[model samples]
Target chain A: MKTFLILGGGTGGTMVANKMSHHLDPAEWKIIVVDENENHYYQPGFLFIPFGIYSPADVVKPKRDFYPQNVEFVLSKIEMIEPDQNRVKLEKGKRTITYDTLVIATGSRIAPGETPGLLDNGWHKNVFDFYTIEGATALSRFLKFWKGGRLVLNVAEMPIKCPVAPLEFLFLADWFFHERGIRDDVEIIFATPLPGAFTKPRASSILGDMLEGKNIKIEADFNIMEVDHTQKAIRSYDEREIPFDLLVSIPTNMGSEVIERSGMGDELSFVPTDKHTLRSKKWENVWVIGDAGNTPTSKAGSVAHFMLDVIVENILRQMEGLEPLAKFDGHANCFIESGFDKGILIDFNYDVEPLPGKYPLPGFGPFSLLKESAANHWGKMTFRWVYWNMLLKGEEMPFESQMSMAGKWK
Target chain B: MTNPILENVEFDDDGFMIDPNAWTAEIGEAIAAREELPLTDRHWVVINFARQEFDANDEAPTLRRITKTTDVDTKELYKLFPGGPAKKAAMVAGLGKPTGCI
Candidate 1:
């Protein structure tokens, strides 16, 4: 029997396992999934946790819940991947497993320690992050009793998962403080390494306008060198400084350490994957999916879902002595939650930038594109249900893997 | 004057025909024409397959299902519809919008 070993039981790995299990014959193939954590987090929902929109229970479940019955699921930390020998070493008991095919889906994580003085005196107390459950929950507690001051939301670096999440947090923060009648007491500031509100120019202008309308300040092009916990300030490499009383920082997000140790990853520990095929550049038998692959796209759950369609189809094709198709177009769509029960949607691919247009249908969209609307907000909320039911099950969604321009305006 | 192709059809906000029964060969051609795609015999094959699948399943068929059942391969499907085959083809076929994670 051919052995298929998948590292990390996150969104990408779980979907691949479940979908591939249905395709490959049990008699000829053995699929095994290895993950260190027992609980699977809906990482997007992490943004809402700090605002008491979703409890910890809503965003987490047993990793086994999403796994297929035929796939063997193992809970263990991967120590290293020896690509040369097609073997993986686990941390516990020094166990090693060999496979005919390997998938690296060990997604990225926040490295708070990478930033100087980030984990010092005010680490979880005043300095916080909403990227993790612990950080979000800690911020939740801090916000409940503490009087508001300068609430600075800083992005330490680029390529963070769900790039819109920090923006969502800031928008939601506006709503949260307004509800508490403390909007006047709080001075909200958004600091990013990017020159504007977002990566895309069109969407950035709209979001920047929204921030301006909300009376929030944007600290554009601020590259942080260190977090000085002593003075409650973040110092940039260029000597620019931004002070804050309560800092919610998205620290440097890096791929799994196992990738770095295995020497199979880039400087950021992300596996160098073919942007289209999602196959590792170095190995024929190896595939990389989700945030683990250094694809030039947003590391969002939606992107993972889109990538899975291509990865699964390519894997099946390769098994049948066919060449894998380079089909993924870096299609990424995101719903930006603005304050006051409104949201905006943006859809783009490798070549096309997001434009103001209707989505799905050209003339009849209930959901507006690149504009804020209540319908888009409902779409954003409804996605949580879609993620747990249709997405994780690896069910075939009606939409194609690629982005469509038929209904969109130029 | 209104384009005769869109004369009698009831389209939703996204320009998809609300009533699948209202679709015809002319409607499909008109939808493709609006998008500046000239429908060849190959385009019809994929469009007919999408409509037939939607009729039976009550939902748009995935790209994988279309490629597996129809003569058009994945690459040819992308060539037929530049960006999104399942979605664009379905629209030209006068079908409802495809749902979930597009």
Candidate 2:
């Protein structure tokens, strides 16, 4: 029997297991999924938790809930990936599972300890991060009674998961404070390593203007040198100081520790993956997807959705002894929530910048791109249902695999 | 008065633009006061809304939608400036200083 071993039952691993289970003959092909944890988090919902927009229940689900019957769900930590032997060692079970084809979807996790003094004292106390379930839940409670002072949002380093999440938190905080009638008492500040609000030049320029409009102070090119929990301040490498009553930090993000232990990862533990094929650089039989693969795309859930078809197609090509197709074009789309029941949508790929246009059906789109409207807000809200049903089911979505350039104007 | 959103935009006494790409109420006011180029309501709004959203959120609004929701007619609202709420709003939003263009 041909063994198919899938690592990490996150978005990429789960989807592949579901899709391949139906295609491959069950008798001939045995599919096994291994992970340390049984709980699967709807990671995208983490963006809204701190804002009190989504509760923990909305994002949490059992990993076993999504695995198909044909696929073996083995809950175990990956000890190592012995690519030369075509096997993986599980720590708890102390068993070695051999595979003809191995897929790694062990996603990224937040690393706060990388920065000196970040976790020394103020962690989850005066300082909190919304990237994790625990952090968001704790921050929700902390924000509840925060009478007001300088609330500084710090983006420690780049290539973080859900790049716009920090911005969303800030906007929601504004809305939150405004709703609470304490907008007057609070001060908001954004500190980032990027020169502008975002990575893209145009988006950065626009977002920079927005920051100026809101009266939120911004400190750009501020590389964090250290955090003084006792003093309640952030010290930059350049000796610039920012004192804060509360710190909502976006700490460093790294791939699964297994990749590092296996000696197949870069400095940050992300698997060096071919941007188009989703294949591991060191081995052909091993494939990777989602935040685990070090691709130059936003580490968002939608990127995983966009990459699903490409990864599957490549795997199939390998089975048939053919060249993997160059289908994935780094398509990424996001819903940016502008306060006051309005939101903006942006869809683009590696080659194309976010342009003014409609979405889904191009001209027929009920949603407008780069335009803030109540309808966009509704669309953003409605996506939660679509994600739970359509996306997780391995069903084909209405949009194409690549980003559409239609209905966009220069 | 404690609201940083409503406080006087203290001009950079050192003439050092900490954020060269950053456009603020002071910059917007300077732009309006100079009237070197045509000023529109959309331009004002983009600067205005961006700053507001950024302050509330701690990041700026992406520029992907600057001209999408706004139009040229709203551009004419720049005439009501001088010492007006529209100008104040523009300044607060980081459009630029008023020119008494109206």
Interface RMSD of each: 15.2, 18.2
Which runs in model 1 stand beyond 4 Å of their true positions?
Answer: B1-102
User: What DockQ, on C-alphas, does every prediction get?
Assistant: 0.01, 0.02
Model 2 has an lDDT value of 0.77
Docking quality (DockQ) of candidate 1: 0.01
User: What lDDT does candidate 1 reach at residue A67?
Assistant: 91
Q: lDDT values of the candidates?
A: 0.86, 0.77
lDDT of 1 at A37: 96
Question: RMSD in angstroms, all models?
Answer: 15.6, 14.6
Give the alpha carbon lDDT tens digit for every residue of A189-234 in model 1.
9988777788877778988999999989999867677898778899
Runs with alpha carbons beyond 4 Å of true place in candidate 2: B1-102
TM-score of 2: 0.79
